[model samples]
Target: MSKSAVSPMMQQYLGIKAQHTDKLVFYRMGDFYELFLDDAVEAAKLLDITLTTRGQMDGVPIKMAGVPFHAAEQYLARLVKLGKSVAICEQVGEVGAGKGPVERKVVRIVTPGTLTDSALLEDKETNRIVAVSPDKNTSVWRGHRCKAANSKPS
Candidate 1:
């Protein structure tokens, strides 16, 4: 089998991946959300899909698999509902075809609420994404934080 390789941009993403290792990472690569090494294997098992491998990382073989960007939100929702966290790695710079190295970065990390896709979101319910920094000082709360204060105690 041909070993898929990770670009320089992807290498940078691996750094972010280390932070959220327990989470199913959607490392954005070009038009697809790529998973590398163990991440690919785990996602494939959880999603009941195919498992493949990509080039090498630190001189070690790397496995990989991915879903298209358009359908990513749907897949993400499924993983989330199953209590799996995801880290979205996005390309920051404008790197087109044959433009040498593509500048990429982990633009936004989506957990639950931060999702903007209508298909993955519920129309009648509210979705929220919360983030807590390591310092325990910078906590970002996304979406509505409102709770029903006066409910019929049933």
Candidate 2:
């Protein structure tokens, strides 16, 4: 679908999603953070949250799912534990503060390999982040890296 065909809010979401295609976008909408389209579908399944349609794009309904902002930490912990990364898109401006849609941005990106939240970690054990990458020289070669990150309250 053309850019002009989508709502301004969706346009903003698309712009951010484009930058992090590999991660789910948690778009802030009022008291909740919403996931749309494919993100909604996947999150609904993984998080066992309600999945519904909001609007239409092109010729299809826009799938959507959301978690209350106040309880987002639990949902986020679940996703991170399930090996999913999330781009937390937050509303950075007041409603109706601008001529267009409320301004939003990816305030933080939480990945399994970059977890630093105290609530998501075990109380007594040291938490760690692990990463693996394919080697450049040979097809079968790969490298792994690990780092310990002490979780702290945010």
Candidate 2 residue spans exceeding 4 A from truth? 129-154
The model with the greatest lDDT is 2
Q: What is the lDDT of residue 69 in candidate 2?
A: 97
Tell me each candidate's TM-score. 0.65, 0.82
Q: Pick the TM-score winner.
A: 2
Cand. 1 Cα-lDDT: 0.68
Candidate 2 lDDT, tens digit per residue, 1-43?
Answer: 7667788888888899999899999999999999999999999
Model 1 misplacement above 4 A = 1-7, 96-100, 112-118, 123-154
Candidate 1, residues 1-154: lDDT per residue as tens digits? Answer: 2223556555566667778876777877768998877789988888876778676765767788889899887788788767677877777767675554566656656555455555655556555544544544656544434332222232
Q: Which residue pairs clash in candidate 1?
A: 4-55, 113-128, 113-129
Cα deviation of 22, candidate 2, in Å: 0.6
